[model samples]
Target: MSQTPGDPRHALPIRLNVDDSDSPADVVDALFLGRFANGEQPYSHSTSIERVKPGATLLPPAAEVVRAARDSDRSATLAQGEGWTLLVSRWSRGADVTVTAVSDELAEKVLREAVDGAQDEPEPQPENVTMGFWYVSPRRGPHRTTRQIAAGTWAEVRPNYTAPVAEAMDRLMKTTPDDIAGRLLLLHGPPGTGKTSALRTLARSWRDWCQVDCVLDPERLFNDVGYLMDIAIGEDEGTAKGRWRLLLLEDCDELIRGEARHTAGQALSRLLNLTDGLLGQGRNVLVGVTTNEDLERLHPAVVRPGRCLARIEVGRLTHRESVEWLGTEEGVSREGATLAELFALRRGSGPASVPAQHDGADAGLYL
Candidate 1:
């Protein structure tokens, strides 16, 4: 089957198996983990088949297991699970290459008609779901805009009650869209204090109201924050105020090197300037930088009042917080550490050790 050409959504590897009877040519389409490059879809068209169940979109890359059973009859195979708009190359016989859109069943219905017409009696199995899988057909263009991991995807931390972070996010959202233009919003704190977690939730919840979302991965900062700003410039502003492209800059402390005002330091300063200066005035950019740094030591320019318009510290959970976590059925209890430490420990897989007391302070993770 000739796949319609399009840019790859994820450069990450995806393995699809085609048995001997099945022509490698029909071996098109790929299933990726979650939204590749964070849902920045590159191609368009056609749903895919599944690995385990007869039908379901493969949401995680880890589930990219299993293979196709090649029957001898030469009938078109069912569309595999959902497509992640990946790029794949192989040889095959069938050729249906047009990026068309259809409902879950209607889509499979059309494919069923196209491939099985006059070939075999169609089985009406209700188990299969037919839905558009963004990219079975491809497109010609630059690769999908790569993801800048400024913010991570939001996970449901709690149900029913909006998490505490929502209070802070409420403030962020209530801001007049105009107020968000070129402003820096910092969420900083000790590790496991939920700074990053909170930001993830904020961005995801606000996605509908915002134009575009871009995360600034720490890995990308091979250099200056200036490079980060350049990303904001290039991203499309699908809606006004240049779609809300929130740059999630983590690891703020790592940026400060050399004496303050040195070349690198100035570069760092420029990063802050880019957000707060004329460049930021109407760009419609809201930078949410999370760091474990002491704000006072940060360059006055970067740490100034309006530079990072709002500075909120996600501190240690209180004693009551500890009880809440420990008393919970699913969460780890505060047996080995404080509520904060226990939370981190549970999230980790490696074995943990409790160090001996210091200054007669037996209180460490044990506390």
Candidate 2:
């Protein structure tokens, strides 16, 4: 972390003109005249990001910008205001904006006040069980842009699984970062077997203890330096719980397949590093990966017994489990059904009638 005498060259007066739809990135871009970098560390290494909290009025998108900056291993202050200073730094994962002030009051004032702009009212906070969704930017990668999905609770998820599997998932949800022995969580099974649905419930249940952010392009996560850096280092700015984060990487069979080391090269190694190697050390981050590949087919390093906190296979529900889930003793056969199929049936539609819905709309993964 470099600290200059708050040089005048870096002082930027804010001119905020945003509404509810605008993100903090938009605000920074509007003021800085370009995109604000994401995944940058703009604070001293000793500067504990855990203590940094966004004002209650700060929008989710803007909160992410600040979080990315503080999570970085380096520092770069871009501008300074009367009571606050703006930082733009790069992390191995991404870069982002940060506002630092001499006092919490000044920080809140600088965060909430928007000169030359209308005040965007804060969205009402939910009473209980709030879940947030984030995705990688298609054009710029995961660190660049993010949006919140609709809030949901575990009650909304209807994934049908065997009793033991369901109970295991519930236990995992209740487990905190402190309880896990390893940093990686591997959820694998056949497609449409409720892998994603169960992940949603886990995210909702663990919201209080950890910040769950998804890597939209899991295939690119290890291959792309920026994407990997962003997800691995970008701590959730909203969390006051020190360094707790959960990274969700779904449908990444190609990245962790048996032949990945021979084909994907460093991708597999990078994923492993994020799991429990040097990169994962000292960061209270957990990596959750979902794949359709069989457990035996995953890279040996990935499936090694001690390498994972939990290695659960999300198979399709059994005949009895499906009957209980569907509430049809005779209508549905005992062959069982996947969560997707059950969802389709619940909608009064056949399995084939499952609409080509986007990821989050039906499954609650996309916010």
Candidate 3:
């Protein structure tokens, strides 16, 4: 028997002795492994797609190469051709397909044919960008969910920032993949100072070359070794491969504050490791963090030289800019206003009032 390079099946036992105590599922799995032990057909190809088109079926196309077919819920199909096997499984959000064949070329061809027209092409929405959300579920452990979010281009939202911040953002918005100098992006500011808004636009500007994902629960992510490893090691599916990924962690004040070493223990160290240490090696990943703490209050390790791609302090607009933005000085203050205040004033409320935060339930996830 021959074995393909890097294939884990090479470690399996040459023969299996199943006892009566073995469960049916275990016996079936053993039998399945037995068929591949000979290594006659060692080539394999696999891909996963998100947002599978509605009403699309994989069974029909899978039948093109195989004689026998088995399907369930019209969403999963399995078929076998001479010296080859194909499997397609789909759920509400996405689908995964895999093919194993005697030759690498055959495996690739079968996979391509099975999913030729099954994926849903993302429609053009200039105001929207697709982002991934990562969180640890009680039942499923670590999981990622993709969503299309509404976000404006930097030009449309330029007036929301002060001059200096706007200038810095101008350069950031125009950044290409080649301009990436470091692994971490730090955004620190007041709660209502448009930090999240800036991140959303950043996602839009870098959409062509980067994939953005938000870790919903940052505290749990770093504290759980298993969860952290799952996220750090997982590969982006389909066309997202080879693209840089920005993992956005919001409101992480406790994790990066000056006292983080005493408070967060290994959490802070793990975060730094993921940014520029051994864990980040060979992984095209960037960490973007939004914190309410002032820059001086952040841990020194997080702000040291050469570790950050950008360290932006998102602040309130100047008084003049606020007056100009509102077109009237009626509710504007001499100290200027945050983006949330501006929105509140526009809605007929006073500048002191906070606008309702967008939870993104109806318009998709934001921030």
Candidate 1, superposed: residue stretches over 4 Å from native: 1-170, 173-182, 211-230, 237-241, 256-260, 328-340, 344-367
Give per-residue lDDT, candidate 2, residue 46. Answer: 13
Largest lDDT belongs to which candidate? 3
Q: Compose the digit string of candidate 2's lDDT tens values, residues 1-367.
A: 3436864335654356689876554444444432221112222211212112333222222333332213224433245454345545433323343455556665455544422132222454452333334456542345433333444455555346666777777678678766889888999986677777677667667777777777666766677777676656665545565747778888888888899998888989998888788888778878889988998898888888788888898877777787778787544555676676666677765652233343545654321
Please give the CA lDDT of all the candidate structures. 0.43, 0.60, 0.78
What ranking emerges by TM-score with the best candidate at the front?
Answer: 3, 2, 1
For model 3, name the residue pairs that clash: none
Model 1: lDDT to the true structure:
0.43
After best superposition, candidate 3 residue 84: deviation in angstroms? 11
Q: Report the Cα RMSD per candidate.
A: 14.3, 10.4, 6.2
lDDT of 3 by residue, 1-367 (tens): 5556977766775777788765443443344334456576678888777777777655334354323233332244556676677666555667767777888998888778777787787886878998889888653478787888888989998888999999999999998889988899999987678888889999999999999999999999889999988888877553267898899999999999999999999999999999999988888889999998999999999999999999999888888898898898877777888877777787675553333563444212212
- Every model's TM-score: 0.46, 0.63, 0.72
Model 2 misplaced regions, further than 4 Å:
1-159, 351-367
Candidate 2 achieves a global lDDT of: 0.60
Candidate 2, 286: how far from true, in Å?
A: 0.5
